[model samples]
Target: MRLSEYQVRFRTRDLLAISGPDDFILGEGRAVDSSRMFEPDVSPYCFDLANRSLVCVSTADISGATFFYQAQRQYARTVIKVPFESLPDGPASPALIFSIGRCGSTLLVRTLEAAGMRAVSEPDFYRQAACHRPLDISL
Candidate 1:
């Protein structure tokens, strides 16, 4: 489909949730409104850096016990693409959590959510970024 067909108005929060450059693009995406982008079910799947656009996908309500990546692959239907420049500026810094394998990271995230805090589990973009980063960097 044509890129123009997927154009939509992106709110500041939506843009913030999709922050950072995407490592790759997911073809021509589907268009959705701002509210859809606000739901946890809808995620920023990737970016079309060449076109300066952000791609988002719908995976239904994933706030329960569903695995994030599994939900994306299984239920993803609608996708949206918006101009990167149209996104408003967000906070200068972001809160992040890091941990090693089997370190209760998931439990901690759930705990934070239970406490009424917003926390994103494993997001695919982070994995993509890690894969695309230069391997020659010195520690």
Candidate 2:
């Protein structure tokens, strides 16, 4: 099938580029609009970095849009496509990993990210954490 002129032109750059509807859009009312607008949308863009074309479609209503890798149009990679439906009713908090100063915590987190895990590196821990860094670890 053929694509519309707009689709050919403003198919969107990428989710990383879009960040959110707060950024500029390229269409109109009942379409990509003004107003730092954020809404449900179906955007298709090619991912040069991942070396795969992708499609992303979602909204804050049912859920926010997500990048469906052309390789796997079923789930998201970097971030959740939609906000969590609900907090777990049970008391099963996630495990925590605390690293000491300059202990290669970022390297560990980067490795996890490369393995497709949602990870973050917090260098401001010294001022952020309430407890003192433990002095030792077995391994």
Candidate 3:
């Protein structure tokens, strides 16, 4: 199937970039506006309740959009409600490291990688969500 000119130009950016929760406002199932970017989207990637992981999918095809790797820490925070906790019942002692910005976190990660330890970094979904929502409005 071929895309129309309007559709081709209509950029499909992430929900955060284009719209907010109120954009999906409805009265008796009638949409107030067709142009608003956000609707009550039920994307699996947005929130995985079962796995307790919020996945942000940013496409590379869009120009000037925030890339996942660039805002790794912020994106990590957006996906959750509670402060991150360690897995209590795990067999091994998980190496949890924290540092201020510009410190050697990257170097530490690299060193761990060199030592053959699998290192998982920034899951900042909460921060990303803050950036997405309208600051003036209340949730």
Candidate 4:
């Protein structure tokens, strides 16, 4: 989806497109659901937003649009999303992150967590910074 269109869609629907370790999309594929996999796709509810149709290219093709999903849908990338409460203490290694933008940054933090590394994201870096009170006291 085009960034502009995505903006509208995001607002319209409470949906998030995540891509690695605990990827909702990765687990959103037909294969994940044994029953669904057994049953052939009869609805053919594919999302074909290509050919000047506000297409946003990913590694995989998202041919259909749906209201709800049970399986993890495979996408162009991988995402490992852990709830904030589940995330570990901060100080995520800068080197461990390959973040340059919004999505990349989120995936990076998850990657670090999956790798059993202690890290925090740029957004949460302040938490780490704020954790330490000044050694020198001032009025």
How do all models score by TM-score?
A: 0.63, 0.27, 0.32, 0.20
Deviation in Å, model 1, residue 44 alpha carbon? 1.6
lDDT of 1 at 84: 67
Give, for candidate 2, the lowest lDDT window spanning 10 residues: 78-87
lDDT digits (tens) for residues 1-139 of candidate 2: 1111121113333433322321223332223222111223433222211221122333222122222222112222211121112111434786468777488875777687688775435422222223323343420
Count of residue pairs whose backbone atoms collide, per candidate: 1, 1, 15, 22
* Candidate-wise lDDT, in order: 0.55, 0.31, 0.32, 0.28
> Candidate 3: misplaced stretches above 4 Å?
1-89, 125-139
Q: Pick the candidate with the highest TM-score.
A: 1
Superposition TM-score, candidate 3 onto the true structure: 0.32
- lDDT for 1 in candidate 1 is 22
For residues 1-139, could you state the per-residue lDDT of candidate 3 as single tens digits? 1110111112223433422221121223212232121222211123222333333322222212233233321222121111112112345776667566577766766677688785533323334454554443542
Model 3 is weakest, by summed lDDT over 10 consecutive residues, at: 1-10
lDDT (Cα, tens digit) per residue for candidate 1, span 25-104: 34554444545555665676655555667666666666554345444444555556667655547689978777775878
In model 4, the Cα lDDT at residue 42 comes to 18
- For residue 97, give model 1's deviation from the true position in Å: 1.2
lDDT of 1 at 11: 23
